[model samples]
Target: MVSSTSEPTVVRVSQKGQATIPKGLREKFGIETPGEVFVYEDEGRIVVEPVPSPDELHGIHAEGHERGEATERLRELRDEEKRREAKRAERLRPSEDE
Candidate 1:
């Protein structure tokens, strides 16, 4: 399913629980077939997200790369994210001067 950003597009889901993403939405989301997308729930809604390719990430650098490299790159990205969250947390906290 596409995000709340666009007008709702009704799609018929197969009995097998698969649904075809529409062409315009696919192009908008950059969902090339023979590729994969990440599906998860957000606030009781189904969210479909494009899985970032290696070129979109640092370290691993390319597609057809090994899982280990992907894992490493993911870990690095997560760590970077944690650091950013920590900084944001600090900013949100009450300052000593307050």
Candidate 2:
């Protein structure tokens, strides 16, 4: 089910509306079993791209940032968000005397 030429290869859809991706294309795109893919239509054509796992996406934005530093920054942001939520909840609580 692999295509050797650059020309588009034809495939048949199953009764369940599933089409098997060419083996060559799947290997080139890192598509794996139990993996996720993004499917969308643009203009008149459909496109399917593999979705990278969170582990694969880690450090994708590591522009001069250390991994540990990035993780610490995320933890700080989460703690700050939790503190803000707690303050907001306190302000919205009814007074015991009321």
Candidate 3:
């Protein structure tokens, strides 16, 4: 459902448990991947959040734009982390001269 709030558009879930987040709202929240965790609260109102994951926050570029994008994206992210760690350890070692 389209929202009227000036802050951020809100989508109400129907009895079928389906809700379409407004285009503007999705863009504002930067929902590039579907697995992105969302926190919600119910107190006469509903709140949504995108929980940060180290893999998502500091990972490789997204992949599989057409199919299995989520899996591909996450895999790429993990691989990126591995590469970063290797580089970090290499830099921490003492040089041969020392």
Give me the candidate number with maximum lDDT.
1
Q: How displaced is residue 3 in candidate 1, in Å? A: 16
Q: Of the candidates numbered 1 and 2, which has the greater lDDT value?
A: 1
**In candidate 3, which residue pairs get closer than 3 Å at backbone N, Cα or C atoms, i.e. clash?**
none
Global local distance difference test of model 3: 0.56
Comparing 2 and 3 on lDDT, the stronger one: 2
Per-residue lDDT over 1-98 for candidate 2, one digit per residue giving the tens place of the 0 to 100 score: 54663346799999999998888877776789767787766446565766655765577577976657655754565456457546865877898999
TM-score of 1: 0.54
Which scores higher on TM-score, 2 or 3?
Answer: 2
Error of 3 at 67 (Å): 36
Which regions of candidate 3 fall more than 4 Å away from where they truly are?
1-12, 53-98
- Candidate 1: residue pairs that collide: none
Tens-digit per-residue lDDT, 1-98, candidate 1? 54542445689999999899878767866778978987766456576766666566665646777768766765565556457546865867899999
TM-score of each: 0.54, 0.53, 0.37
Deviation of model 1 at 9, angstroms: 0.6
Top candidate by TM-score: 1
How much lDDT does candidate 2 score?
0.68
**lDDT (Cα, tens digit) per residue for candidate 3, span 25-57:** 556555555645454553443445544455654
